[model samples]
Target: SKLICGSYGTLAVIDEVTIKTLPRPETSLSLLFESDDMASAVALIAGIFASPHEPGAAAILPQPVAAAAGIDLAADFVVVIRLEGIALSVDDRAGHLRGMGGTGGTVETVPQALSETLWRRIRDVDLLADHAGDIWKLSCPPASAPQIIAAIEPHFDMAFYADWAGGLLWLAGPSGADFGTALRAALTLHGGGHAQLMCDRGKSKQLIPALQPLPPAQAGLSKRVKAAFDPLGVLNFGRMHDGI
Candidate 1:
């Protein structure tokens, strides 16, 4: 399961799959907190995660991205925390989050309809869809996000946002910039993480790796596993990595 799940169709052919779906929450609410910058937004998200709220989802959207998602939070950035469950419980949790202070700016509560729209935009990358660039998905420690963003700021004109309480970053960098190298460097300096190229745009795959390179031992294991599953090297050869 581990080998085939993220194999990008390299390991085997999946003819049929089964998935279990959960019933929708009875109600949902999103708490929007205005933040002066990314650091403050991340801090706010961390506080929420530390509390007992058990947020359904959390994200930080820069003003431009928020606007793109039809969210008009007139601030530099907006930290969004969503709560879901029975209507009464959701309302109670939201009130607790509101009283837990240190928000630094205005706070607003969005109803279920708008909350669903906002999360859908975040989940579907609707905020980044109109941008003309290559898309990179970065995963790192939540606390290191601000530093990583700072490190990569000088390399390219980019737009980005954080989800999963700042642990996952979605970035859109100019097509010609060396995104993989720059992002990997930042991740290395701040904290180890992975960056995957989600969209090609105009960049050459030969020039940039679509997936992060594994360590020597892991790389060897990956090759062995690949050979075991597709010995002839015929199934999506080089689809995820070179010479796999």
Candidate 2:
């Protein structure tokens, strides 16, 4: 290749397969918030973010996740929420969520077999390893991801694979997704860090600009000089969503 520039989640996921067993592993717990209306559920969890003394992982689906798995969505919405840590912590959180709505949805520990499947889906990047597309990494407080997911998930038709334990999300949407708007909304609700998008397609270029921590005056001077060099604005304007 003539050039290469991008962020790769895992250059490699596994060298070989191996397994180990624990004599007595700690228990893992999870909850399913079933609702015909997902919008309401989204608000409930968003409320939790307001006070995150102990938040494990929360994901709200505007539509059923079955569509992502190739099955048509049958319900209006379904939210999959998980809380894990020490056994006592997880148990307390689970009890809280259950008390939110009348108990109907199933509550079960993520089975060992299912855990391996989710891990492989997230850890393995072989399928997308070769594509040339800009990869955007959005960073927000861990608790805010669910609300952010809820806000944008309803608008776009795309694929999303989330790694909540690591507070990582990978979303592939249409070419012109409103990343700036989405980021702002998420930041407002959850309150956290900035985001980075690495261009992986169309000549392996860098799309969004790298963030800096310099004083505002120096940053402004640098921006002015760059604009002076290309006063006609010939470069891909606003690709970084910053108005020059």
Clash totals, every prediction: 0, 2
lDDT of candidate 1 over 1-244, digit per residue (tens): 7778988888999999898899989999899888888888888888888898778888999899988877777999888999999988998899889865485567889999999988988998889998898889999998999999989977688999999899999999877437778998899999889998898898646687778988899889989999999999999998888768
In the range 159-231, model 2's lDDT, one tens digit per residue, is: 4434443255555444433553465456566656555443334422233343312247865764574466446
Clashing pairs in 2: 132-201, 133-201
**Model 2 score (lDDT):** 0.48
Off by over 4 Å in 2: 1-25, 35-39, 46-55, 61-73, 85-96, 102-109, 119-134, 141-157, 161-169, 175-193, 203-207, 210-244
Candidate 2 weakest lDDT stretch, 10 residues? 1-10
lDDT of candidate model 1 versus the reference: 0.87
Model 2, residue 32: distance off in Å is 2.3
TM-score for all models, in order of appearance? 0.94, 0.47
Q: Which candidate gets the maximum TM-score versus the true structure?
A: 1
Shift in Å, residue 30, candidate 1: 0.9
